[model samples]
Target: MEQLNNTFVAVQAASRQLALLNSKQINNILVAVADAIMEQSLFLLAENEKDLTRMDKADPKFDRLMLTEERLKGIATDMRNVAELPSPLGKVLKENIRPNGIRLKKISVPFGVIGIIYEARPNVSFDVFSLCLKSGNACVLKGGSDADFSNRAIISVIHSVLKKFDTDPHIVELLPADRQATSELLHAVGYVDLIIPRGSSNLINFVRQNASIPVIETGAGICHTYFDEYGDTTKGAAIINNAKTRRVSVCNALDCLIIDEKRLNDLPLLCEKLKKNNVIIYADAKAYRALQSSYPAELLHPATTESFGTEFLSYAMAVKTIKSMDAALEHIQTYGSKHSECIITEDKSRAELFTKVVDAACVYTNVSTAFTDGAQFGLGAEIGISTQKLHARGPMGLEEITSYKWIIEGDGQIRK
Candidate 1:
């Protein structure tokens, strides 16, 4: 908790002086951070490996945060791309002329200090710093204890880069990885501006309920992709296959597949593709019966009600063969986490309609549901996939990390 206090103090100093720093200084720091990222890539990978090894025997949620060498290179690349993005702060959003002798301007500015409490993804150390710097905000990062050492190494690299410019290194600060310490800092709403809890549903819910600060809850990707009766069979199979099997452990992966009843006959082909990838198929009663008659009995079974809300996070999916689009929407509304959804179809009208009706951050027409990422959206790098309905909705980037303020510069214009 004391660590967060020191972080807050440093961030406050930076936030106060942000308006004085020109775009060149910010850009220079970004370039330097990228340089440092590339230089320290080897050390980051080694540190990550140590954490990854510990993840092997650890619990499920803890293990998911462990990273590898390839992932480390990707992180470095992500930072480089992020450094190349446009500055989000100090932008002229709007200027208004009032009836009186007053000119009001609503310009983009930085949120004072962002406090992020996230799980195993240690790369979030860079993500928060990159976005905060680009957005002209300061950040206090609290990583999960499971990857404390890894987080330390990553955070140190960021601070080291800041040191070159002789800037306050603690502008991108790391909170102590103690569970109780996290609560203590979270409750200090006066210290931090906003809280973004990016982890499990239970963890986020607790933070939202208990924290004094406002929270941006993200990471519950019990996402769904529907295959309408008028959908293209090939595209349906391909999209669902990619969404489920591409990287099963990630949040954007598809959890359920809704196939139209008229298209149930084609289930054999879809099931075959999934089976080849060793995906466990949980079929609703209709799909179970239909699949049993066409394919082997082992390929069919009645799905439980809880299966609809289940997030496999592995090479597995639960399929519900619906009769209409209304059923699809009904099921989704009941079980969907409102992260990302897809409608695999060639019909322009239906696809457009589905995109409009679906209440998700990203609604895809025929693309794979897995493409709901920051890089895919051309945002350089993503801090996290935010499911919250606030300032940020999807892949949180530099632009999303910022908040605007109405800066009124007046020359002693007193109220008459």
Candidate 2:
């Protein structure tokens, strides 16, 4: 508790200093961070290897935790891109002049001290720092213990750049990887303005249930994709395969697959493709029976009730059948995580209906759900894809990290 309290004090003080920095200075720091990452690639890789050696290779989070030199370059590229993005602070969202000659403007501003708790992915340390700094917010990071060594190395590189710029390194602090300190972060309400959790369901839920500070949910992706009666089987199969296997250890990966009953014949073809990828399918009664003869018995299993809503962040996926678009929408409402949902259909009206009825941050038509990313959406880098609809939703970039303030000017105007 004492450590957390001191960390919060430093963060709050740094937020004030951060607010005073010019956009050019921030961009320069970000560029320097990118360069530092490239220069320290070997050091970072050595640190990352320590964490990787400790983790099981078969674990779902292993892929996310392991950072290769190529991945480091990608992270560096993203940081440079973030530095080039427009500054998120002090933008006038709206302006007005009243009949009494008073001027008013709604301007974008930072949320002060931002707390981010995440797991597995060491690159997220860089992403969160880039977005928070660009938006003029100080961050307190609580990374998973699994990637402690990697995160420390990455944060050291960032801190070096901050020191080079004569900025307070506390502006972006990584908290101790202890569970007790994490719990303390959840209760730092007055100090941390907002908290964003980006990891598995258990982690997100723990932060949501225990935090006294405001939280923006960013993980638990029980995402889905439906194949309509009018959908092209080839396209649908391809989309589903890419969405599931492109990167299985991500929050945006497809978890559940809904098929139109009219197109049940297409199941065999889909099963064949999934089999090639070594994907395990947990199917409902009907789907189980249909897939038994088509897919390998080893990869096919009957799904329990718990399987439907579960976010299997691995090669396993759930399968179900629905009669119509309405049924698909209803099933999604019940099991979906509101992260990313998709429909593969040639019918325009059906696609429109699916997009309209589904309540998710990102809804796609005839496309893979794997594209649900901040960079893919042309937003540079992101903190996370927010599942909640409060302050921010979807891919959280610099703009999403910022709040707004109203600026008013008057000539001695009084209200009665």
Query: Which candidate comes out best when scored by lDDT?
Result: 2
The digit string of per-residue lDDT tens for model 2 on 355-398 reads: 98899999999999999999899899899999998978999999
RMSD values, in order shown = 2.3, 1.4
Candidate 1 lDDT by residue in tens digits, 8-107 = 7777787776656677787788778777767887787778777776775435454466666677667777767777777787788999777665777887
- Root mean square deviation (Cα) for candidate 2: 1.4
Clashing pairs in 1: none
- Report model 2's TM-score to 2 decimal places: 0.97
Candidate 1 lDDT (Cα, whole model)?
0.79
Candidate 2 residue pairs in backbone clash:
none
